[model samples]
Target chain A: MRKKGLSLVTALSILSALVWLAGLAWVLQDQFFADNINRQAETLKPDTAQQQKEDSSGKTLQIAAIGDSLTRGTGDPDGKGYIGYLKEDLAKKTKKRIELTNSAIKGQTSVQLLKQIQQPQIKRQIKNADVILLTIGGNDLFRGGQALEELESKTINKTEDVYLSNLKAIYKKIRMLNKNGIIYHVGLYNPFSDMQDSKTTSSIVRKWNYDSANAAAAQPNIIYVPTFDLFELNVNDYLYSDHFHPNKQGYQLIGERTASLIHFREEDQK
Target chain B: MNKLVHNELLKLFRKKRLFVIILIIAALVPLFTYAQYQEVKTTREKLGNVDWRTQLQQEIVDTQNRLSSSRMQDDWRKYLKIRLAQQQYYLDHNINPQAPGAPTFMRVFVENSIDLLLPLLVMVVAADLVSSEASGGTIKLLLTRPVKRWRILLSKYLALILSVSFIVTASAVLSYAISGVVFGYGGWGMPLLTGFSTSGEELVTNTVHLIPQWQYILMEFGLVWFVCLVVGTLTFMLSVLLRSTAAVMGIMLAALIAGAILSNMVSSWESAKYLFMVNLSLTDYISGMATPIEGMSLGFSLIVLLVWAIGGLVVSFAVFTKKDVY
Candidate 1:
């Protein structure tokens, strides 16, 4: 009886071991096969060796603009957003051509943009750029707009001064990194221009533009373009039916005005 | 009592039962590790030239498209939730879930649970644990000793419990040791995605917070032993319940196989939750990969399994302690 029991154990033990081995084999599929995607994002910082490929003069001008929903094709029917209009306008006016890279993620702030710009892939492009057009610090201002039911007409201003300082710091840092670059600090557009508190928020918005212009003025090759006039008090002419982003006409007008502004700058530089 | 427990242990090791457990560990450990190693190697080779974030974003978009294209309306939302979460997580953290996360030891220890093996190992030696002695008429000689019948049974039970615990610990430790050989020993500090959810709210799926993978293994083994203990106890019960050892083994085996099959097939029937076998593979349901019979939560499944186990123990003790040892 003992020998028979022992024999049964031996045979069963072998079978059990085989099955257990199979189960273990099934579970460890990831370690041997799965890709290390995380390391890929971090390993490649801006390759400094690629820094020698500079054009020295005006090659094809590469422009990068970033911002919130307006820049993210949020309110655009065709989904090209402002970058497309800006590109068409610039191409039509300059007729020389430009490379536009729109890296604008929806609902991003300046702090986020700064971090994004520091990424190796983006930093490489920014280094070779002739112009950097950016629309930012809007989401930071009107973040409470999402809670529109609870807080409307009430401006979030006190902490905004710090926001502006952060914005200044980002611009200053970018200027230091990329010398001889023209900075187009695209000012805010009043989507809520019809509101009674629109004028007060407009100054708050203008102060950012004014502060940005001053900050840009203090740094060489930085220019602030005031776009508030194109949208404020004439809400109907520019804004979409949603009263958030601008319509095609509104975008075209802004594009045309921006193209004109760049033309004047080119003439001034020449 | 201690001598008997030790005697039981010695007797256990003297046979193939202990060797089977060791064999399982030896075979499974390296296999699990190598599988993990292969995964990393394949990943390394595929990502040999590709950019990580773009690849990750593309994967997310691909998965999103796949989810959007197929799946019925009811299944669509769940698939979308998974896709949406991946996209949000990718945009926020720049990670691709379909890509590699951790080494083999951590993956095996945490994700794919070894719930089936323990009860199975128990079932191997368990059928003939006591009844085979009676069937071969060796009980007459064994009982001739000063050791009482209940004492003998108690010793066997204790011995069985000790062996079960040993098998559990061995399986888990071997999994870690073997996987470490292939994947490297980096799992100690690594974070794992232990994400589980009921409704829409995101649960912190970080595999680190709730418990270590080893503890999860231990808990799993504990539940396995408890379930197997019930199996062993019932087999031991049947050894007394019937005169034929073959009949006892066959009945228990059939019950287990039927339970496994019925758990899957006997769906929509709410009462199927009470079946002990339905909850045997408890980890799958606990991780929310599959649902327990209607209205069954992890806690609910645990209670059901425990009750069946304890109830089995009661029947085994009652029947075995009072059996005619003719």
Candidate 2:
């Protein structure tokens, strides 16, 4: 009986291991394999001229969001970051298909983004995008050092003017990438709102946001959304344990605020 | 000792373990070879109908068009774009992508053996050797013979080593013979372009090289032997730990499966670099990209395997010398 029990346990263990592998494969396959399969299926679907015209309406309303971890669903306990809600909100407000493709890596900077713009993959996304969004410039100011603890200790000292100029370079690069792409620059928010440095950071952030907003004004098709207003004082409600990234509620607000920009665009288009 | 060896060989003939191991090797080698056969068949089919180079060039253009609008976050997508572009460039410039000379079948086998199934057969044979004798109580009878204890164990070890080498070589031979039946043995001499990276712009030394197909097969046979020995030594360690034949096989199999899992998810853990599974897959480095884990240099992985082999050797010797069976 003990031997039989042992064999049963071994069988159970192997089965569980296989199930784990199958589940993981199902998820990754759903992502990579499903894209190809779905695309193939879509290709086979007949595209009537009337259907093409209907799809065209959705194209101008499409929002293409690009950013660092914040835009990539980093802080949200749920998988929905600002982009997710913005997608949903615009869909409901316009009652049309408001599509979004998030092109955000965990650790990317404005300088890297400028380089990314030159890459063929990023270039195509920029060219056809009706609405473009970005939350870059953090990694450029503070380089990632593998660990958060190390990042805190190895922080660099740069004045407000230097940060503003770098932010200016990023906006300029985006304009150069797409002369006609409608743009949104989500302003930087304070994670450490309780501390005195929050004010200092907020002021610097305001200056940075001012430059972003100012630059957007210079370009005709750009919109600057102040994300700092959503979560500056509500630390307990929004920030995650790391005290840096947003919690689910904070991201909801960010998404709604960003979606509000899309809603405004949709109304103007109508 | 020669008479004992003859008797042991007779005993092995009657029992199913050795036959089962050989049967398994024969069965599995064909599985992978057949998979390769199917893929090549499909490629040949596509090649027959269209200009193969033009199809590849069109794929490159399509990938470029898709990539032109992204933030470029996915590394795999970037790698594909780079690869397709380089292939396109080679075709565009009228430079041969497949190179001029041909590699021998032997060299190709050795290079590709680590990728598929030969290591699996090694597990089957090595996991059962000593522990099966112990579990059957045949070990007591073998010890009772006129031969010295150390000499008897040493002889069994030598037998396993010889059989392992033969089995590994047999697997490669079986694959070539069987795959030749289906693939029809063409392109055995075509030069294969390897060790090129389009990740960077400079096109740093495409490193075109060639060898006969037969030599490639032999080198692959030797590489398979190394890999089997590593796996055999690991199973041998498990056999010592469990002492029961079935238990040893189970534990080693579990370890094999787990090691594969841990290596893939081991993003931050430095200690996972020491694992044999990650160490054994060094062929990826030869492809000119960094390993799955950062800081896991090829040299570090080899040293870790050497350490494990040495540790296994020391344990087997110590236990075989001192253990009592009453």
> DockQ of each candidate's interface versus the true one?
0.03, 0.02
lDDT, each prediction? 0.59, 0.57
Output the lDDT of residue A257, model 1.
Answer: 65
lDDT of candidate 1 over B1-326, digit per residue (tens): 97776666666667667677779768866666667668757755654423454345434434543443444554344545554563444444433233332343544453344334556667666667677777878878878889777788788776676665556556656666666655555544322232233333332233211223333343444444456656666666666667776888788778777776786666567788787777766555333344435455555766786687677667777777677778
A207: Cα error in model 2, Å: 37
Candidate 2 per-residue lDDT, tens place, A149-186, comes to 23232242343344456566666766776777778877
Indicate the residue-level lDDT of A250 in model 2. Answer: 85
Superposition error at B71 for model 1 (Å)? 4.1
Q: What's the fnat for candidate 2, on a 0 to 1 scale?
A: 0.00
> What does DockQ come to for candidate 2?
0.02
Docking class of 2: incorrect
**Residue B38 error, candidate 1, Å:** 3.0
